[model samples]
Target: MRFLLFILICAGLILTAESCKKECHDRSNPDCENYDPCYGKQPLTADFETFEVSIFPDNWIPYSTDTLASSDVFFRAKEENVEYEWTVGSETITTRSFTRKNFPVGVRIPITLKVKRKTDFGCFPTDSVVAQTRNIFVIDGYENSKVAGYYQGYHTNNAADTFTVCIYIPEYSMNPPHEKTTISGLMNISTCADNKINVSGSESVGYKQYTFLSQDGFCHGAWGRVRVDSAFMGHIRIDYSYLKDLTDIKSQVDKTFLGKRIN
Candidate 1:
């Protein structure tokens, strides 16, 4: 009876050892209590948020000598207690939160956030995570300026015909002796070069006013208004009158244009 009892006890010990071996070896199984399911996986989480602020406000006038033209992007990490490294373009920053001043405009930017934490798992040693944020576009301050971009729209008289216009205003100064602004367009409007334009408006009106005349010995004059909406959509309206070279008579144009900012 004693020998039989010893044989049974040895069989029970072997069965218990086999069960434990099966459970522990299946480390990926969630039901296995003795083994970690997250073994060999990245154990750290990394995430971040970004906010952009335009350096120039609605009433801001851009001067040629004015230095600040780019926007600012603020970055913040959602997690704490881990080492942080931020990669922006060719530069790198090591901080929990930071503000990037004078960020470039009119292009998509990819910002990367990397974090690492000390781990108890010797095989892994350190838990590392990488997160990426992209499609960051900083609006150019010059976008808000009048006579700065290509515009397209239709006149009320002829909706079927598209009128495209381009305006170029040299970087402006609030003080006098400003550089010349120019306008060129299709559909009855001739290129008016060397326009001596003075832009004036109040904040309550929410638009820049440009009353200009051609200095190139032609009777080209206009009262124009330009507004940049919140979505960066540019709007322009010109009441133009010029002496036609063919008829030697004055012609007029009253139209509004909508366009996107290229700069």
Candidate 2:
């Protein structure tokens, strides 16, 4: 009878041990393939909330958003519990659009976006992104002047040979200068008729100067000259001036009884 009681006690102990083992396994195993319970809980991403800024008319400045869209600036989420902050280097940014107000022509403006995210465990993750727009206000080869016109001129010696020049000014800049302004553009001396000049070059406007050379033969003549008036209202009056020769003029009038020619 004692042996029988011992055997039953042993069986009960074995069953209890097996049940405890099964419970431990069930509690520890994760549902997903990796079986890491803390995987999603940890913060894993850091990124910019926006990648680009939009400018609007009347000095409207628009900022980027975190949503996913073709137009929306996209940033990869680094980790969970993220926070975003934006900064514009220049105050000239007016309105919802990134209108660089009072921004100097040929200046490069850098805009920054900062992102902060935290994990479920209270750890913070931070990251930042930057976008740069160079000479955004001034178009290439176009400088501070606000004048636009077609000017033609030639070297003083040649009347038949001619050259054409174009000047472009920014739409902004109240009271833009009319004189003492050097307008630069590309010129094809060989192919004047084609006139395939690039107003804007590889560099942004205000960053570099552009120059066009007149044909070699035209350089020696009274080619051309154009001058802008003194007014500061973006109005440029272009005048084409050429050289003239007088062949029938006499140097001296009748010198009485002298060897001088008569007028």
Candidate 3:
């Protein structure tokens, strides 16, 4: 009977060792049947880019969604055939690239990326995205004296909307004063919409009635927003950081805004 007990003990030891490893026999390669995903996972980032703390934001929610695309202002990641999900400011998409046409121009938005990866046999787990890029559109003369100048009135196209614009003299893009500008502004109830200051980051601000030169002479008109029903009067707001500062882009764009002149 002692010998019989010894044989049973050896059998139990063999079974325990087998459970600890994977076998090529199962389709899912799980130690047990129907085992869940991530029972054991290959280290992520091996087949993808390494994580950099400085590139991603600390808080994830209200993230602005975007993708890896190639353009003058955007840097596109070259990875393909790999699954990924992008979450931008409460929305999710499944692409790896985007263009200026994809989002509202000149707005700064937060973004997030999730890579689809195999965490178990026949299963994939979504991993955090691993890249970053600019979140606002850039244009020539975007911060020019015309569009950035001040005005007082309502969008002529829409009677209900009122506006008061103020543009300071074109700032010195250079230390010695190259007559450049920056992108920043505030709302007021008084008259101060006639300065020639240039600002950066956004081109959404404008005045069309007076043919401002900062507009690159294109008559985008005196519309705070390109859309007639867009932000009105002191209602236009900007994300100060989203402004871009390039020394070129001084040309006419396709959009136009019509509004009354402020007193």
Candidate 4:
């Protein structure tokens, strides 16, 4: 009886070991059905492989939404076992929107996005992307100058020509003490039709009419010069303003800047 009991205990132990072995077998290994040498010793593949990030509108604006259009910007993480972080060097941004009371002018803020992935073995690798945002002010020069600039080009059917407005700053000047200078401001235009003006052939066409201010801070001023480009048409109808300001500077751009399509 003792010998029989010992034999039964040994059989139970052998069966338990075999059952565990079968349960943990590697299906990829043909010999795993009976004996898997690689069982419990399998290699691991890193879960994280790739990721992507992006910013919306691809441009930054410094004025209030009522005065200027706002854009949405964001970044995304696409890998497993990965973590993400974002930082802006100057202004505080919330989910891609600037939240500061005032954006510092003439400053470039670096936006950084970082991604880190961890391997099964506890090894970590990192990736990063960086961008920048510039601050600028908008000034309205057309309202200050009463001259209406007309749009003239081959794409008139789809394009409407009107006075271009820009932001102005006293600091901008072509020469001398560079006293108070007038720059362009937020763009608002008056079509020719709105002003009771006639549209002729490839000549000149107008759509709307709007009042502009003067250089002396007056409400009504006539434009003095007119300028047109692939992107905008400037009319210096108001003495306080000019047809257009320098395009190389950000402060010179207004709503009319969007009208010009540069090839």
Best by TM-score: 1
Span of ten consecutive residues with least summed lDDT in model 1: 198-207
Instruction: Report the C-alpha lDDT of model 1 over 139-195, residue by residue, as the tens digit.
Output: 454434444667776665566777566666665477887555555562343333333
Candidate 4's C-alpha runs over 4 A off are 1-82, 90-101, 119-151, 154-263
Better of 1 and 4 by lDDT: 1
Instruction: Looking at model 4, report the run of 10 residues with the lowest lDDT sum.
Output: 199-208
- Model 3 misses residue 17 by how many Å? 4.8
What TM-score fits each model? Answer: 0.33, 0.23, 0.23, 0.24
lDDT value, candidate 3, whole model: 0.35
Can you give the lDDT of residue 133 in candidate 3?
Answer: 32
lDDT of 3 by residue, 29-63 (tens): 54555565555544333122211111222211111
- Candidate 4, residue 38: the lDDT equals 40
Question: What are the lDDT scores of the predictions, listed in order?
Answer: 0.54, 0.33, 0.35, 0.30
Model 1, stretches more than 4 Å misplaced? 1-43, 53-70, 120-127, 141-263
- After TM-score superposition, what is the CA distance of residue 70 in candidate 3 from its true location, in Å? 14
Model 4's TM-score against the true structure: 0.24
Better of 1 and 4 by TM-score: 1
**TM accuracy, model 2:** 0.23
lDDT: which is higher, 2 or 4? 2
